[model samples]
Target: MQRKKPYLQPYWWRLLFRANGTAAWEAMGRGPLIPVPNAALTRAPLEVWADALLEEAPYELEDLHGDLLLECYAEPAVTDGTPPVYSRQVRLPGK
Candidate 1:
């Protein structure tokens, strides 16, 4: 069976350098990041998409990998509603 050569998407080197610097190459000994175009990313919710990406990301720095992928889009901003507000754990006695 022929082994297919790894595909490093355009500008991935720059992104990886910015993300982990030379240390990444020294550690991993190989780079396998593939830039998924905006037209390719799924329309799933941000959190769900993030979880899936994190689970399957080939890069050691998942956060950076995810960010870099998102940055490829023209607009990486999230148009969802604000996150839920959580109240402090202080004692609120009203008995």
Candidate 2:
């Protein structure tokens, strides 16, 4: 028996918005990545933080269409050194 690795590792969270919320004007947090062991814990704080930030602005909080999304994908560790699974290949000239 072996410890199996996760196929899709948890990545960044995408906070999407509509209406008056502009994605270009916003910036993601640059602080240390807090290891939240539970997904339930992550949602409340993220939503609260987003709401608090938006509250300071002129946008109507209720009117804003927003969702906190977890972005996950297969990490490099899962793909590295695996044969045809790799996409890029070094081709010899004229071959």
* Candidate 2 residue lDDT tens string, 1-95: 99985343333232222323444323224432223233533555434443444444334333334332222222323232433211211111111
The per-candidate count of clashes, in order, stands at 0, 0
List CA RMSD, all candidates.
Answer: 16.3, 16.6
Model 1 TM-score relative to the real fold: 0.21
lDDT tens digits, residues 1-95, model 1? 99986543222111222242323322122434333433323444333434454345444453442123221222223233522121111111112
Candidate achieving the largest lDDT: 2
Clashing pairs in 1: none
lDDT of 1 at 73: 22
Q: Score residue 16 of candidate 2 by CA lDDT.
A: 24
lDDT of each: 0.30, 0.32
In model 2, the clashing pairs are none
